[model samples]
Target chain A: MAQVTLRKLVKMYDEVQAVRGIDLDIADKEFIVLVGPSGCGKSTTLRMIAGLEEINSGDIAIGGHIVNDVPPKDRDIAMVFQNYALYPHMNVYENMSFGLKLKRTPKDVIDGRVKQAAQILDITELLDRKPKQLSGGQRQRVAMGRAIVRDPKVFLFDEPLSNLDAKLRVQMRTEIKKVHQKVRTTTVYVTHDQVEAMTLADRVVVMNAGLIEQVGTPNELYHTPATKFVAGFIGSPAMNFLKCSLEQAAGALRVRVSDTLSFPVPADRTQRYTPHVGKANLLLGLRPEHITETRRHTEPNQHDFDMKIDVVEPMGMETLVYFSVGGVELCGRVNPNAGAAEATSMKLLADLNNMHLIDDATGKVL
Target chain B: MTDTAIRAGAAGPKYGSMSRDRRWALRWSYFFLVLFAIFFLTPPIYMFITSLKTSAEISAEINPWWVFNPTLGNYIELLTQDTFLRFFRNSAIVSILVVTITMAISVVAAFALARMKFWGSATLATGVFLTYLIPETLLFIPLFKMFAWVNETLGIQLMNNWWTMIILYPTLTVPFCTWIMIGYFASIPKELDEAALIDGATWTQTLTKIFIPVALPGIIAATIFAFTVSWAQFLYPLAFTTSTSELVLPVGIVTTLIKGDVFNWGQIMAGALLGAAPPLIIYAFLMDYYIAGLTAGATKG
Candidate 1:
C-alpha cells in the first residue's frame, strides 16, 4: 500500500474543464471515495490518478514519485471499470491471471494467484466460465480478482457496483469493503451514490461542479455538511433548504424559517452568524430525519413549527412527513405511530438547535 | 424464433385463421422465391447453356433460348490458346498480389485509426475514411499521366503491364477496407483495450492477440472485397494494358474471343463463367461473415 497525492490536478477537454483543480492526499491503506453527481468530475479525477487520462496541469505522486508521464501499466495501478471490463474472450482463470502473464511472472505464480483469488471470492467453480456466462455479481468479483492478482500499488474503482441489480449491489458493496479490509491496499473509488459513499468510504470527497466541496468522514458530512450542496447530496430524500431571514427578537436573534413560523436562534450560533441580523437572507438547512413529532424529542433537541402536512410516506419504522416552510417543500421523519393523519395540519418539532445556516447567495455554510 | 412463436400463439384465438394465414404466407414466400430465383439465375443459366453450344449452332440461330449440338469445343479451344492462358495467369497474379498488399496496409491503418489516440488522430481518422469516397474513375487519368511522366523521366515504363495493378488496386482497396475495419474495430468495446492495457500488453500485442482474433469476420469480408475488386477491375486493366500477352481476363476475352465481324460467343460465355467462379465460391461459403461485417454498425454502436 502507498499514499497517493494529487496536487492541483486539473483535467480540461479543450475549453470545457472537467476538473478545474483538485488537491487531495490519501494516506496509505486508506479507502477514499470520490462521491458526486454525474459530470461532477469524480470519475475524471479517479481516471487521472489511475493514469487512464492525462492531467491538464498538475502532478500526481503515488508513493512519493511524480508519475505525470506514466502509463497505467507503468503506474502499477489496477482499475475496475463500471462495466466490469472483464475480457469477454477469456475464461475467469485467464482473465484473473492476465496481468501476471503480461508481467511475465512465472506460470506457477500466476496459477497460484488466480487460484487463491478464486478461492477467496468463492468463485473457484467459475474459473473456466467466460464473463458472459457469469452473473453480474460474479463478473464484479472477477474484475476484483483481476485487480488483486497484480498486487499493484493502488486500486482504482470507477462505479464498480453500478451495473449490478439492487441486491447484488449491496452484496458486492460489502464484498468490496471486506476485500479492502483484508488487503488493506490504498484504494480510490468513485461513485455517485451517497449511500454507497457513506457506507464504503473511510473518508468521502464530495464534489460539485468540478470542484471539491468537502472532504471528511461520512458521519461528519452527514451530521455537519460544510455547504448547501453537501447537505442536500449526502442524505437520502435530501436536506430541505428553506429561505429565511435573521431578525432581532427579545434582545437576541430569531431565524424566521417562514412567514408564519420563526424560532429563536440557539444561544451558541447567534454570535457566529447574526452580526448582520434582519438584513441577511440566510438558507436554513434541515435533514429529513432531524424533524419529528415532539413526543420523540427531548428538551434541548426540540423546536415546534405549525405546518400543513402535504404528504405522508409510511416507511416501515418511520413516517416521512413532507410539508412546506417558506414556500419550499420540507420533509421530516416521524415515528410510524405518530398518526400523522393525511392532509391535515399538525405541529412538527424540528431540531432547530442543530439546524445549519448557509449564505443564501453563495451556498456557503454559515 | 421463440418470440415469434409465442406472439403467434397469443394472437391465434383472436385471429381464428392463424394456420390458414400461415399457409398463405408460406405459399406467397415460395412464389416470391421462385420469381427471385428466375430473375437471378436466368442470366448465368443462359450463359452456361450458350457456352456448351458450338459456334456453328450459335450462328444458325435455330432457337435463341435453346441450345442444340452441345459440345465442349469452345472450352477446349480457350484452354489450349497460349494467349488466353497468359491472360488468366496475369489476372490471377495481379489480383492475389493486390489483395495481399491491400489487406496488410488497410489492417494496420485501420488499427491505428480505430484504437490509437495520438496527436491529430480524430482528424486523420475522418480524413482517411473520407478518402474512400474519391472515385477511382476520377483518379485514373492523373495516375495514367503520372505513369507516362515516370517512364519519360525515370527511364522506367510502369504501364502496359499487369503488375501495375498491384500498385493501383491498393488505392481502391485500402481506403474502403480500412473504413470497414474502422467501423468493425470501433464496434468493439473500448473497455477491452483498457483491459488489455492494464494487462500489460502493448498496443501491438493487444491488437494481434485480442482484437484481430475477435474481429476475424470483418477481416474476412474485407479480404473478399479486396480480392473481388482486384480480380474484376476492368477499366484500369483495359486502359493501361493493351498487348495480347499483357492483357487480363476481361480485356483478353473481348479482344481475342471477338475478331472484327465474328464473335466466338460460346468461348466468351465460358470465359465469363470461369472468371465469375472464385468470388462466387468465396461468397457462398462465407456469406454470413460478409453480411455480419457489413451490418456490424447496425447491430452495435
Candidate 2:
C-alpha cells in the first residue's frame, strides 16, 4: 500500500530551476513513467521522489508519511541508475544482498532473499562473477535484482535502458515490464524515449522545460493531448503543425491555410472555435497517420487537399510522404503502393475531426 | 618479359630493403633498451657487489664490479647491532603508521571534495593540489620552529622522536594522495553513491562499503605512495631528529655508517641497498596499480 504523493515539489540547482513545483499522486502498484526530452526535469522529479535530491520546498509522502526531510535509506525506496551502479568489487550475489546485509538481516534470510531475487531476475548462474564480468544487459538485470531483493516501497529508475543498444533496450524494456508485473510495487521510471514510456508505463507524465505538460494513460495522451507541446512531444516522427488563421468566410468558420486552400471547421468543433474566428497565427496540429492519403475508409469529416511532395520515405508497410503547406513541412503516411514520389503532386487528406487547433501565442489547444 | 615477371622484379628489392630497415629499427630499439637497463641498474648492482666485499678488497682496486673476497661480514655485523636493529624497527613503525594516517585523512577529505559540492569545494580541491606543490623544504623550517615553540611553551618534546616522522610525513603525503583519490572518486559515476544512499546506506556506509571497495586500486596506489614517501624521506628526519635511537632509515644509515671523515663503504652500501629493497619489492609487485593511480586523474579528468 505504498502510494507516493508529491506536493508542490521544486528543485533548484544554484540559479537554474530544474524542476518547478510539481504535484503528482501515484497510485499503489501503478507503473508511471515520466518522460521528456533531455533536461526536461523528469530525472530530477524522480530523484526527489527517491530521496536522492533535496526538495527546495515540497512534501513527498510514501505510504502516507511525509519523507521530504527523511534520508533515502529511511524512506525505504530503491533506485536503479542508468549506468547500473553495481559495486565492481563484489560478485552478483554480494551486490544483490548488500542492502539486506546493511539492515543486519540474518545470514540465512539474506541468502534466501538474494537467491530468490536471482531466480526471479534469471541470474542464478552468474552469482559468483563480478559486475565487470557481466555484459551490459546482464548488469542491468543485476541492478534490478539488487533493487528487488530489498523489496522497497517504491522503485525509481533513472533512464535505466539508455545505455544499451536499440535491440537490447527493447528486450530490457519488456524484462522491466515483467519485473514490475511480478513485484507490483509503485514504480517511477524516467526516460527520454516516448516509445519506452508508451510501451511500459501504465500512465505517462509528459514533462517539458521544468513543468509537466500532461499526465494520463498512454492511449489518452496519444489521442487527447492537453497542450500543443504534449501533442508534438508524445509521438515519434512528431506531430506536424501548420501555421494558419481561423477566419469567417461565406457565413462558416474555416481554417484558412492560404489564398489557395481553406479547410472548413468540422461542425462539432465550430462551437469551440467560434470565439476565435478572426484570429491569425493559429496552429493546426495533426499526427502523421492522421494525415494519410484519401481512402475509401476515410472518415466523412476528413478534408482532401493537393500537396507538392518534397520527399518520399518508404518504410515497407507504409511510406512517409513529405509535403509543404503554408511554408511548413508536413508529413503524411500513405500506402507504399500509393505511387507517391518526389517532385510530384499528391492528394492527401487531413482528418478535421481529429485535428488540433492551438493558439500560437499561448501554445494551448482550443 | 611477362607482366608478372616484370612486377616481381621491380618489387623484390624494395620489399627486401623495407624489411632491412625494419630490422635495423628493431635492433636500435633493443640497443637503447639495454643501454637504459645498464644505466639504471649499475648503481644498485654496484652497491650489492660492494656490500659483498671486505674492507681490503673495496679499498684495493680490484674490479669495482666484482667482489673478490665475497663475505657477509657487513650483513652479519649490522644485523647483530642493537642500534641498527633499532633504526630498522623505527623506520618500519613510522612508515606503517604514516601510511595508515595518510590513507584515512586522504580518503575522507577526497570523498568530501570530490562528491559533496559545497560553496567552495571546487576551489578547495584546487587548493589541496596547490598545497602539494609547496615543497616540504620550505615548510620544514616553520615546522621546526613550531616544534621548538611547542617544546618551550607546552613542555612536550615533539622533535627528536622517531614518532615525529609519523607526524611530519603525512604533511608531505596527504595532499598528493588526496588529489589522486579525489580524481578516482570523481571518476566513479555519481550514480553508485546515490544508489547506495537509496538502498539503506548512510554517507559513511557508502564510503566504507562502496567507495572504498570500488576504489581499491586507488587506495592501494595511495598506500604505496605513502609508504614509499615515509620510508625514503631524508630531509625532514635530517632537519628535525638527531638522536641515535630516534632516527629513521635514510638519515640513520647516512649518519651512523659514516664516522666523520671516515666512511664505512661496505656497511653504507649494504644499508642503502637494504633500505631501497622494501620500495623496490612493492613497486615490482604493484607497479600497475601505482601507475593507474598516478594517471587516473589526468586521463579521467
What's the TM-score of each model vs. the native? 0.91, 0.92
TM-score of chain A of each: 0.97, 0.97
Query: Residue A321: error of model 2 in Å?
Result: 1.3
Candidate 1 residue pairs in backbone clash: none
Predicted candidate 2 versus true structure: per-residue lDDT over B65-178, tens digit per residue = 877679999988888988888888999999999999999999999999999889999999999999989988899889978998999999989988989888889989999999
Q: Candidate 1 chain A, which ten residues in sequence have the lowest lDDT sum?
A: A293-302
- Return model 2's CA RMSD, one decimal: 3.6
lDDT (tens digit, per residue) of candidate 1 on B58-162: 888488688767788888888898988898999889888888998888888889988898899789878877888888788889998899899999988988877
**Residue A62 of model 2, lDDT score:** 98
Clashing pairs in 2: none
In order, the B-chain TM-scores come to 0.88, 0.89
